[model samples]
Target: MNVLLVKDDCGRSRKTCHMPTHTAIIALTKGGKQLAQRLKTLVPGSEIIPNKGKIHQTFAQAWQDHDSLICIMATGIVVRSIAPLLQDKTVDPALVVCDEQGRFAVSLLSGHLGGGNALAQKVADVLGGQAVITTASDVLGHTALDLWCRDMGLAVTDKQGLTRVMAKLVNTGSVTLYSEYPLPPLPQDIIPSRTLDAADLLVTSRIRQKENIVLLHPKALVAGIGCNRNTPAKEISEALDHACRTHQLARESVRNLASIDLKSDEPGLLAFAHAQNLPLDFYSPDQLNQVEGVAASAAVLRATGAKAVAEPAAILSSGGGPLLVQKMKFPNVTVAIAEILQPFPTLF
Candidate 1:
């Protein structure tokens, strides 16, 4: 993965982003050599790009070239630099903000799947500072629904169904059960679809063609996340990938993307959410909070207030297993994806 490090104000110009398959580090400053030196020590082999103008100018230039952005500056500067880069079509690099003192590191964007969350943690570890991570699943250290699907080798056939199942799991910690064949009872709903092909049925239960059976299980929740305007889709995708890798899960089982009502119209997020045939579930902040064990970040808490732990936490907590996917970043935005899992039906 190519990482970009930008520091403004270094006297000389160095283009490390051009290196073959390496992470680029751009240091933004008003012409300071110290920043460059500091970044070199922090991220070895990282390309250092210097901009002597405002942070936005540096971002404008480097924003188009990097996969992830780490800001070793104050929070205000970090926010100002990225303000202009936010957009729908662009997969924004994961954004991390760190103070010069490096006392606390915050992942302002792409905390879950986008890698910013993980990156922030890594930077904090390196700097010997506290990484203020706020993702619910990370704090809880439990398997999410998407992670479960990936682990079990199942495919998501219906995004809507998956979303519904996840929401219920987060809210009530359980889901209604249903099935079509004489399969062993599962903990959740197991509605057999006539349109489902043999391949769709990963487990064989009493081979009935069209029967309606119901099972209820508590471990079938899912997670859903959204990104800021223009956040890179790639960042979100990477986050999901990292989540899966961290949990040793698979990718084929993810079912849907969840977000607030406002983000439902975001073209970039919608494109990703729909592409996987993942259902898009939009809820109010209040509705989101029904999920248990979800950690709320300052950004998510501020935006949604008491809603839910932002969209990502709800998805992460609701999902029963590890994370199925990570966040993908676009020009300026990122998103999270996951799958829901239920018990395999057996007929004997």
Candidate 2:
């Protein structure tokens, strides 16, 4: 895939396969234009959209091009211009409204998951103003569930359930929390539940279909794989999928792939990893030998100088974590899975 060069907040160049618009600032009046220009310099990776006199047309053009939009116009004007382009909150860009005098930055749309509140605060900081955030959780000084999921890289299973749980959090100021892995410090509003049945929010790799519960799947599993030479990519993918399904694991939680260095250039493994957008790590035979308690195969030892490939590689990639799935063999593939145990974000 072709790559693009992007600049970060520190003005450092980074390579990316896709170039998403970082930020776009649009303004109408002269004072608003001046504020937009100042923000272009203050906010990293931000650019001012040239106003062509037709403010609605400019907003329409920017709505599809940017991940974040800062409108230096009246809040009503912004709402009207973006109404037609509005879609699901998950897909909509961060919308922030700032006064022409740079007195206040309002998080008008997509505040939690879209990061509009953070952007508003940043703009206010740069302009010496105050940020107006109206989210119920933020106003009540409680941890926003959606923002927590975003920061922890969790995938919510049910959107409507999450909304209901957020409302419950704001109304009652507490929700039961359950996790399969260790967690960071909990706030007063998050009461830990000992069982999944009694929990209102769950963090696990298991699939659940119950209602009135917000389920979040963490990217915590590492799949180690070994395949016969010249195996097809489709076969390898199906083998992994079968393994995950058989073990009742969520496919979204498989973080990466691990294999021996001898198969580093294997076309099947490379293609599967690329299609899944998962990182692939390779280890030497000596490193694999260091991992004990794995099923040793004489044929694998003779061919690759390692007694086991899939099980040890999974353990190594997971930072020496215990295996969740022991080695399973298919016609042309061997697979193992391990939970990645590491430090989580303590900010929550």
Candidate 3:
């Protein structure tokens, strides 16, 4: 949790300045020294970076580095500094604004906008301050549809589109969710208005519903793995992380865990497959032989007792191809990640 703190117009370090992990404090006045000392007492491991110039420079630098912003300055200064950064969707970080006294913490931008609201609450709790959360669903104690989609590892293709849908949901007190399979149970307070069949949904899920409904697709990211017998679970986990980052795919989107049948019972693969909460599908030797363009090594073939030389390639094709491949040296394993591409119907 990286935080960026800015000084207020009064040019004073509030006694409430406490640092957490990966914290950076930027001040427009010389007051940063006092804040840094207080932060060191609160968070020994925190890093405090001070600037006594314009607030916008600090904001721009923080934005460029993609750090979450926690403004301890005036509300107007915080607002002005963040306005430009908000326009570009790709670079925005969670933005939280707190008074110099730290009595009230407000989530001004990225409130469910980009996870700022949740971060604000967490920061407020740490400081023993009041979190002035304004997101309507959160204030009403209703399940937030966008947050739900994020939790399910589904991407929200259009933010404005989701906004419109949420507005409808707020007014109607009803929204539909579509899925090809039965969804995991939702909060009991949420009642389904109706279930209709339509091809358009905001997120990934096999189910479809009529207008004014939210759709949750099953996991769309597939993990195709090839591991050695009795491989360590840590190696497999690291391989999965590497592959996911290499492919620029969210770890949460991983829907299916796949491997060769010979290694299905391997403890490492089994544990990793289960931990991700995805279905583990094993491919038989014959099935491994069927995938085209697979590069198998003699060592892999002999170790797995498979007729084919490349177990990783087979796993990818079986799981779905154009997969991200990660070769492990310790356990002599390889992992692949594939992103499911689904066609969505236009919702007018």
Candidate 4:
């Protein structure tokens, strides 16, 4: 998808990826299979995987492909089947276990970051059961740090620090939050801090890291490129890295890329976008010229129809958002960065 959209209070569309969209529902017993069939219909992009008696083989085959797995079987069966396939929680798929009677849905693994808790709750709603969430934050009725970051489309920069912060938050029952952008009313446990130094959790695109501080980088930045013909992907990558590093911005915060339509067929640019798995938006000269506050370049105008490529393209692609970094030149490439305003969802 080019840009994932979430509706704001005024119904304005904003870019956001809430959670895993693909799910695999697996069942071993006849009664369990019936429950899985019902779930497959209610869950979007979910498929029922009939157990062929080899539970390990079935799990191994579907482990890498699916974002989440719902096993309609005993919790012990699921725990044993997926134990060997468990990896880092960040990349591990969410696992939910449901009883054959459909009386309880348990978030078995990756409760927060991998969205296992949310999936369990959803499954419970569909089956008219109780969702068993054991995560400390959920049990205590406090803000779930990892879930909040995931819902906001923010990447955790420091995994170790996040764990520490989460432990402390659960113990102390509160955390101070600092953000570059304005946030909506927060949970009772999350108090907004005016300064970054006083906060335990930070929401920003800037690359800030410290001991015991959890940095959440939102995917809200767009990069615009102006490159010479046949500019290698390495050169473009280096230019982007240099710009972000020099400006203290996190590369993980970049949402997509933008460029003039004249370079739509450029192989190097296409390769770079594909490698990064980022959507590249191309605009015509007329569209670029309509954007204001872009630096004009006579050379760019002569080469392409647009007076400016990097600056105007960034501005237009960001929906007229303010520029964070004006055109910065490199050996064979130029880059400009813009911030797309992200709306904060209701946190309470």
Give all candidates' CA lDDT scores: 0.50, 0.86, 0.57, 0.84
Residue 295, model 4: lDDT of 88
Q: In model 2, what is the error at residue 189, expressed in angstroms?
A: 0.8
lDDT of 2: 0.86
Order the candidate numbers by lDDT, best to worst.
Answer: 2, 4, 3, 1
TM-score of each: 0.40, 0.84, 0.56, 0.84
Residue-by-residue lDDT tens digits, candidate 3, 1-348: 222223334231111123233434444434435543554455334445555577778788877564465666677887877777676433466677766554667887767746678767765676677888888888877667677766655655456667776665577665555444334565544443334453224344222333554444446656667766787878888877776566555565566666666665678766665555455656666666666555656776676655442334324433344544433333456766554444122111
How many clashes does the backbone of model 3 have? Answer: 10
lDDT of 2 by residue, 1-348 (tens): 443434445232223343455899988889999888899999998999997777788888887788899999899999888888888788899999999999999999999888899999999999999999999999999989888888787888688888888888999988999998788877789899998888999998777776667878888898999999989899999999999999988888888788888887788887787677777777878989989899999999999999999999999877788898999999999999998875253432
lDDT of 1 by residue, 116-178 (tens): 776778778877889887654455553333334433433443445454555544555443333
Model 1, C-alpha of 301: deviation from truth (Å): 65
lDDT of 3 at 104: 68
TM-score of 3: 0.56
Clashes of each: 103, 0, 10, 0
- What RMSD value applies to candidate 4? 4.2
Q: Write the residue-wise lDDT of candidate 4 on 149-185 in tens digits.
A: 7777788878888888888889998889888876767
